[model samples]
Target: MEKDRLVRFVGKVMEESGFKVYKDFKTSRYIIDIYGVLPTIVGDMGVVVACKNYDEHWEVGLDVLKEMEMIGKTLKASKIVVITTSYFTNSASNYAGRRNIKLIDKDGLVTIAKKFSKKENEIYETNVIDENEDSETYIPSTKSSKGPSIFHAGKRSLSKSGRSKSVGRNLNLGNFMQGFKGIMSNTVALIIIVLLLSSLITYIIGLFNKNTALIGVSKILSSAILSYGLVFYADRDPNVVLTKGTIVFFVSMIIYVVLIVLL
Candidate 1:
């Protein structure tokens, strides 16, 4: 199965199992393929799911389980389930067993497909798995249910489509604001802003006082600030700093000479 379809299939399975499912659930640090919550008498249990649509030969590794474990901890998930079209490595299986994480290999996937076929009256081509078969098999479902399309899973109460739309808009706005804040907070960006503002303010003050000296001082300050910025950029990429700094140096010198002659 394709990765996207596998995610949706897993989500549908979760929904069928009495859990509220969310597709492409985004967290602060990670994007969960399928997030589910199963409510019980005690409390709601969070389930973090990862879907891997690998070839039969390619086995899911220990690193994938470790990553899922970290994601589960971040989401405070009660259960971590990994469903893969392929099998799992021995180390991965051992780690999952120790961590109490549920791993569904190709055999388990076939079993799930068979169950869904029986329950939903859908036909699956890979009902029986042959040990000797080398080619890949897909379980196609005709079920119209697309599962949950929302990025977030909330209370069990059914919310209107308008609410989901609003939530999506809010999330987009929030992400844009966050990105803006990050850019503004960057040290290099702040330095550039300061250079522009200081140059403008100095020019204004010089004009008001009718003092050429203040304007000269402003040019000097701007050059110093530019040099500092160049030095900072040099730490990141020296080639960029060299090219830009050389051009800026000549340009500043020409501008300063013109100002001296004109003033």
Candidate 2:
């Protein structure tokens, strides 16, 4: 019952992604739930899908996946996509590899479903995929480019917004470094000046206790300046920025501030 729901869910995702769903197709040995077109194909080519609930199994065994692979190969499936509620074991992965079968676990199923769904939804291009172009994108081969854009909305080109919208993105170690480089390039001198100015302001606040409000406001400005400056410098630099380093720097700075207060 639950497995049927999961299968339906996967089907819905696949449908949304623009793949045509032909469900409940019987093969020689097994009944396949969802068979759909790959993102790169138009007209006739399609991929096979085998959906499983996996209530009892913790992992997909090699035998089950291999059987499905054989069936798919017999059906002339370009790829055998197995969507299971359970993940595949290491042995299962190896088995699939030996047979050139593609496996999608629960998590992987969701991802592939989403990806295919997104491709299917290119309302802009409803024509058959160009064989040469689509083949290059869909098939798993070393000849493909590192960042080949296919099954995208239209005109496989990167937009400026896509390229430049890294400001608020959650970055990894390498990405953080890239962002830090950009940040540094944009605001290095400004940060240094702000740091010096903040130090001077701190010195002034210490000496002048006359106007508490004025001192408080100055302190806030100094802190903001210092913080913004540092962040800007880190982001603008075209290189020399690490995500971990930035996080550590801020965390340490916060600790240092707390220590200063205690002292």
Which candidate's lDDT is highest?
Answer: 1
CA lDDT scores, all candidates in order:
0.63, 0.53
lDDT by residue for model 1 (43-87), tens: 566778999999999999998898888897687675688989999
TM-score of 1: 0.47
Candidate 2: residue 88 lDDT (0-100): 84
In model 1, which range of ten residues has the least summed lDDT? 148-157
Residues 1-263 of candidate 2: C-alpha lDDT, one tens digit per residue: 38778767666665544456778877767777877653331223455777778864677787777677667657756456776777888998876665435677777655655555544453223333334346544443221111211112222324323322331131122233433433333333334444466658867786867586776567556656465545544333223234433443454456546766999
TM-score of each: 0.47, 0.41
Error of 2 at 167 (Å): 22
Candidate 1 backbone clash number: 0
